[model samples]
Target: MKDSFAQLDLTTEGFRLLFEATWIQRPAGLTATATAGEWRAVRTPDELAAWALAWSDGDEDEAALFRPELLADPATTVVAGHDPDGRVLGGAVLSESGTVTGVSNLFAAGDTDPAQVWSGCLGLIASDRPVVGYESGDDLTAALAAGFQETGPLRVWLDA
Candidate 1:
């Protein structure tokens, strides 16, 4: 159900298909100038694949699990940052602990303090598992600032 985008290769058409098929519109506040603070949840595999590639550097397993079809039973929380025109600049999704997770792709400018954004994302996940796959810079800094610590040694899998 994870939309199969990662199963093959990522492309604009594939992304579009995934987005159109899996994206769910929700009420979220957004702004221009690359400040996408508003959030809408994703519920389809294709949407999850697109988001994962864009945000997590094409993490296949992470993206695959987020497929809307697979998350049908649980809450696959999708949050988006949009430009004034409502194009997605970045986003994040919350999955059950063992499901999909990655760094926060906020669209705030460099001057914007990452700690603040970290707090915002933390606020979204109440009574959930520890967030995983953060981008490992400001994102990780923000997570630490917001009271999340590493649960184990860092690990990554690559194709041989």
Candidate 2:
């Protein structure tokens, strides 16, 4: 079940194993310290614009998809990291607060590690709930190191 990457048959047992493998966790004692690792909005119009751009892969049209109301929703957590002095390092969007979360827009300052940023974000919301996301390349690596497991993959089609 654990090493079924090659034996993935999607059988009942395979599905069960796949389900069990997908998860996220904060390393022991590796969570936030008050406001240092807090989850909040981007804090400025410019920052929000940048975050939206990153979330949309530099597509300004897709960036426009995120409205202020949606970004500030009580349920959606679109957050950026800050030092004690409060500098905007990076941020992410963790959605579906009530159930399994989907992570996105994982960007951070070069000085900070994206995986660690994700860990702190997940700690704020993970709370023993499962977190899911579409990841590839380095993002996929970061996800795995952040305690996520490979369940499968994803695809998206543009209708416009």
Q: Give the winner by lDDT.
A: 2
lDDT of 2 by residue, 12-130 (tens): 43243222222233333333333335456565567777667755557899889777776566667777766675665567887875556677667765566667676667656645566
Write one digit per residue (lDDT tens) for candidate 1, span 104-133.
344333344555555445445543333554
Error of 1 at 78 (Å): 2.7
Q: Estimate each model's TM-score.
A: 0.45, 0.60
Worst 10 residues of 1 by lDDT: 19-28
Candidate 2 lDDT score relative to the true structure: 0.60
Q: How displaced is residue 24 in candidate 2, in Å?
A: 8.9
Q: Measure candidate 2: CA RMSD.
A: 8.0
What is each predicted model's overall lDDT from 0 to 1? 0.45, 0.60
The TM-score of candidate 1 is: 0.45
Candidate maximizing TM-score: 2
Model 1: residues >4 Å from true position, as ranges? 1-36, 43-75, 97-117, 127-135
